[model samples]
Structure formats: C-alpha cells, structure tokens
Target: MDFDQVRLHLNAYKENDQVIDAAKYLLYSFDLEHENFAGFGLRKAIPNLFLLITEGELGEPQKVMIPPNLFDFDLNLVLNVIAHEMLHVRQKSSINTVEDKNEREFQAYYEMLFHKVFPKIPNASDFHKKIFADKAFEYYRRMGENSELQQKYAAQKKEIEQLISILL
Candidate 1:
C-alpha cells in the first residue's frame, strides 16, 4: 500500500482528531526517503500472520507483509506493526548478525511503542511502557551475557539512538 492508503487506514481507526494529528506527526518522523522502504501489502501465504520481510540476508529494502484477512485488524494497529517491522529492518542494516535479530526486534518494538506511538494517543505509552520495559530488560540482559551479541546490539543501539536524537 502507498502512504495515502496507510493514512486512510489511520483515519479509520483514529476517532480523536488530536490523536490523529499526533499520528500524522509520528508518520512524518519515519525515514520515508530510504529507497528500500515500501508501504504495507497483503499476502495469502499465512492464515493470520502479519509479517514484515526484508530483502536478502541484510542490507535490503523492507517489505511489510499483512495477511489478506486483516479486515478485523484496526488500521492504526497495522500501521504500528508496520512501523515496528521497519525499525527492525533499520537495525539489521546497521548491525549484522543472527543473534542480534531478536534483540533488534525487541528494541524496535520498545522504541516504536514508547518513543513514537505513545505521544499520539492518551495513555497508550503508559500501557505499552509496562510491556516494552519488560521486553527491553530481557533483551538487554541477554545481550550482556553474549559478548558478540552485546557488541552488535550496542553498535546498533547507539546508531539508532543517535539517529532518533538527531531526527526526532
């Protein structure tokens, strides 16, 4: 889907004008200039899985995969999911390793939910923080034990933090 379709979806689920306005701001914050970045699309491969698959082993453009049967899924929910997956693609390009995959996913989910999406809706960040914090701690704890993974995670984390600090 294109950005306009994504925006339409966002508008459908978002009733609050203020929340929608904030989401528009967040959407603009995403790195949309990347050549590899594409909007969401539906697939029939899985029954109910909404996956975002990137090209190649790494350093590939990201593709958001949504099941065709997402009629029941809320529009903003799908947008957030796509945003989270795109974060993973960004992390993967910066850090190379299989072990870092899980950590990157955790970091992306946490950062997107807490830093990006939370400001858009009332109490959304507060509710998601509890979830994100637990997952971030677990990922961080694992990274501490795995020296190689720690190095990779730290590098990617620093890169992401710097990018966010500079751009957002």
Candidate 2:
C-alpha cells in the first residue's frame, strides 16, 4: 500500500476509527536518532524487534528510514512498518515496566504480522521478511534448537500472555 492507501486504511479502520484524529504518535524516520533501534514505541508493545545497532547507521532517504543496508521492501511492508510505529502512539502509560513495554511491542507486532505476507519484495533484501519471521516466532509460540534462546522466548511469551490477560 502506498501512502494514500495507508492513510485511507488508517482513516477507515473500525477499531481505530479515531486514528486520524486521535493518533498521538510522531512517525519519524530511522535517521533522526530515536529510542527504537528499528522503530520505537512507548506502550501497547510486543515480543521481538530488530535492534540493528551497528556503527555508521545512515538515514534512508524517506520520511521513515528503511535502513539502507537492511530492507527496501514494497508499499505494504513499508506501510505496515509505519502503522507499527503508529500503534505505539498511545496515551501516556507507565511504560517503564518491562511488561508494559512487551505488551506494547506485542500488540504492534501482532498488528504488523496480521498484514504481512512472505513474498520477496522487489529489489529489497529479506530484511522485511526476516522482521516478520522474528515476530512470527514470538507470536506463534515457536520453539527452536537453541535451549537458551528457547528458554528466553518461553519466558517472554509467558509474560506477554500474562500481561495480555491482565489488560483484557
């Protein structure tokens, strides 16, 4: 989806009917140096986020930075990425809590996952797909060979679910 399409969708979203008016987040590029390594948020968050913290992080030439060395994906992925950040724009909450942060990331990632497809975006690396994949692994309660990673994943999932239940 292009900018207009995303705007239209966001404008018409049933759950987020007031998104256009009530949206309280600033959509910024990866360049300007913010808290999020890929994209940042306050609360209503989730499980996994790619934190590319290498030296010499250059800004991609767009409103939202695409991390030139990372993915150059298509309109939907880009829009979803934007939407992910938008989802982070919520009323002031005590995000200092780890659970709150995970909840925020979890919700944003779930929304992003809901809109993603696993096709090769033209001229873009697998970075977009990889991002989705990482989120998927977290969201779907996936298991892997690495015991330590699995344990950490399991713990995070437990906390995420616990937080969701409390929030609901």
Task: Give the top-scoring candidate (TM-score).
Answer: 1
Model 2: worst 10 consecutive residues (lDDT sum): 53-62
TM-score, every prediction: 0.50, 0.31
TM-score of 1: 0.50
Task: Give the alpha carbon lDDT tens digit for every residue of 1-168 in model 1.
Answer: 355665565556454433424333434644432344544444564555544454444665555554544434444454555466556556545345333656776566565545553343212233444554456656766666767666656754555445445443
Per model, how many backbone clashes are there?
Answer: 0, 10
Give candidate 1's error at residue 19 in angstroms: 22
lDDT of the structure predicted as candidate 1: 0.51
Worst 10 residues of 1 by lDDT: 117-126
- Candidate 2 lDDT by residue in tens digits, 1-168: 144544454445424433322122213321212342334222221233322211222232112222321222344454455555444433112233223344445555655544332212122224554455457456444344555435655654555445454444
Q: RMSD in angstroms, candidate 1?
A: 8.9
Error of 1 at 163 (Å): 22
